[model samples]
Target: MPTTPLLSKYPEFGRARVYLFGLTAGCVTGVDFVASSMIGIAGAHIQGGVNAAPEEYLWAITVYAAAAVVANLVLGRIGTRITFRRYVLLSLLVFCTGALLCASANNISELVLARAVQGLGGGGLFAAARIIAQLVSEPNERLPIFVGFGLGSFTLTALAPWVSAELALSLGWRAIFLVQALVTVPLFAMVLTLFPRRREAPTTAQMGTLGWPAALAFGFGALLLLHGIEDFRLARIGLSGGETLALIVGAGLLAFALHWLHRHPDPWLDLRRLGSRRYLVGLGFYSLYYLISGGWNYLMPQFLQGGLGFNFQTTGMVLSLAGVVGLVGVMAHTFNFRRVFRRRRVIVIGFAVFAVAAALMSISAMPGASIAVLMPPMMLQSLTTALIMVQVASMTYLDFEPEDFVHAYQLKNIMREIATALGTGMTSQWLQTDRAIARNDLVGRINTFDLQTLAPELPRTSEVLARLSLQIDQQATLIACDHLFITLAGICIAAAGVVLYQRALA
Candidate 1:
């Protein structure tokens, strides 16, 4: 069959074309962000809907990420082979079909399978969108474009939980899945109309050698690594109190995968050229950001609801407040930012501010603390999120050649997904362990003699004893969280220090 030649030279888009590209970019990123983030927010509801336990339901999220990583590897080739336009269209079809299946799922198995399918398509969509975004603008002009992208995506991220919760409560949990499916229809039409159709591949562009062996090895290695981490966290696969078997095995597999990618001719991922010191620094900062963001995200909800005894609705409201305030601040700062502050300075401040917020929360959180105490720090942390996001986006790929944009984009996002999971998993593991230890230490201090002194409202009775136990549990959880938040503050400081150390991000 005949097709147009591949785009050897990039076009300088006009004002209208720029706006069209921005719109498409927003839709492309927005759908994936909302759907993926919202699915996470509504996980408990979905779990209940499918009658799955916590561990079982988690596979839905895990599988989605793994599938996406695999999809990213494939799409970088497929986009060039089939033309980005056609590949994206087919990806959208796969995404919608998976969404529909997810909505109709009757069991955990069905839902997990659907999520994997959805992730495959979403991964392709994201890689293509990012590459398009990169190609459309020169490096010097990308900050504003990135700020624009961050505004919509982060705003949607902030809203996804509230929206998902509302939908689940009012329209049933299936509404979450339905939104993903329905939203793609208009997006499909928009992409078809707006995306350039002249970039069909010529015969010379084919990936003549399939890298399936290395690709599968990399994918499996990633899954094993994830499973190993999860197993260690759950205390399931450890032996002799040494490094866990799964982890050791996973590490070996990953080493082999990397070796293969390094040595294999026509490897699926030719990553040798992309690993400059500057690029590696960018990747490090990305992991730090994800760790902080994901860890806090996992912790804050529990702190609000469990530690402070706020209801689910109240927790959502507080989070929404933080999101809105952050969005407003980010928008105000975006236009005049270049004039007001240097990128390096802004990145430093972003991490520094998060450290401040974490420290504030570390000290202020208590069983009797009011929302006012939590709101300021939450808002501060949320506001800096956009700062780090915008700065990182504009700078991460500064060293990559135009030809490497597709692979570079995929690698960046792939690391981001992994770091996110690690952040949540590591925090959850520590919190649970610390909470139990705190609870035990607190329990050991309680006795009939100390009960009246600790709480004068309680009498020496079984019912009052139960109340005291509840109070102790609350106090213990808060103690664990307070300790954890302080540790996070130290990490944020280290993150800021790294930003200050790196000179290339500017």
Candidate 2:
């Protein structure tokens, strides 16, 4: 690759450079939010349009997540090897292509494949944005940019449902992808103009140590594990034969991958680094945070739309309040709170807030619950999520050497994707099982004799029975949601204990 002379020059945080950098960060993060938030709304359209089964819609997310996890690691390294500017531009082009494909997709399988491509590109955007931030700004100057990035991302995430719903209502779900494809054009132009191209060629040794084999193995292992979890969840109670076999194979592949990492001189991931107790503890806290937050993100939309009988527009409006509050929270932390509070203390406080919010959410899952009942928990959870994310990212990298920062970044991104998938999978499994139990219990109370006794008023008609059945299902779902929220509260409390224990040991 020809090197641009501009590549070696660092910006001195000029107004124009800062504005462009912020725009780039916002654009990158916005892509992620748009993709993630679309899943809750677009899944229905994809299912109906493609005639897909309920379980099959999950592939739209799972395949994307798996692809993104692998791409995040691989592309992060590739960017270093090739040059961040070229790699990001290529990724943007690929993302646009994927979005176009998604817009044109006529079936579920095509959509899933397109999403995988999109995820690959999306992962690069995420990795490259951070790399650019590191390259252009001094350490002290980077914090505000990151704060802005978080606000942009969270705002998009909160508003995505509404944007998507309106697009789908007015034009169609395909419009969402079309819009994504169109928006990337200006972003592509900005990257070409603003981002500096690489000047130096990567060393032969650097190129040789790319670890393609380990990367492939790890990616496959992760995909299999995630697929197995999805399979287990869809099976309702116990793992099906296929799910069991898939899990076993996935575990075996992961073990093999670990062994390869241990033995390889230049492994893709530095498994040896796990020996650091601080790193391990940091990962534990990070995973726990994602487990709770991911589950909340996945389940809340359904709870609002299904349990509370809110339409997509109403649900989006209600959820958008969290984003508003979260932006405020991020600003507060960035400007004032972070200066006063230590990272560990901030994290612990965030976890406590999350636990309380989760408990409140559990209590708010009743039949006649109003949007007012949901607001406090939603606001608190969003605020705490912002607090935790910023602190965790800071704390996790505090001990990492410069050379190890890439590895740590890759590890964190991979774990984040995996944790999110697991969170959604576990919540789905719990909801299914709990709903079944609740439904059975509810049904058990109503017998033929009870129906006969109520026939005078209820008429025992099929319409009445159908309505009764729908109510039962809704009630069961609400109870199941409550149970999931309470479980998350417990998890948050346990995570707090983990944080405190690690602090004590330190």
TM-score: model 1 vs. ground truth: 0.86
Q: How many times do residue backbones clash in model 1? A: 0
RMSD of each: 4.8, 4.1
Model 2: number of clashes? 0
* Model 2 ranges off by over 4 Å: 1-9, 233-238, 273-276, 448-462, 504-506
What digit string (tens of lDDT, one per residue) describes model 2 on residues 2-44? 4322212453335455556666776766776577567655556
**Runs with alpha carbons beyond 4 Å of true place in candidate 1:** 1-17, 105-107, 137-148, 206-210, 234-245, 329-341, 449-470
lDDT of 1 by residue, 352-402 (tens): 999999999988878688998888899999888667865776567778788
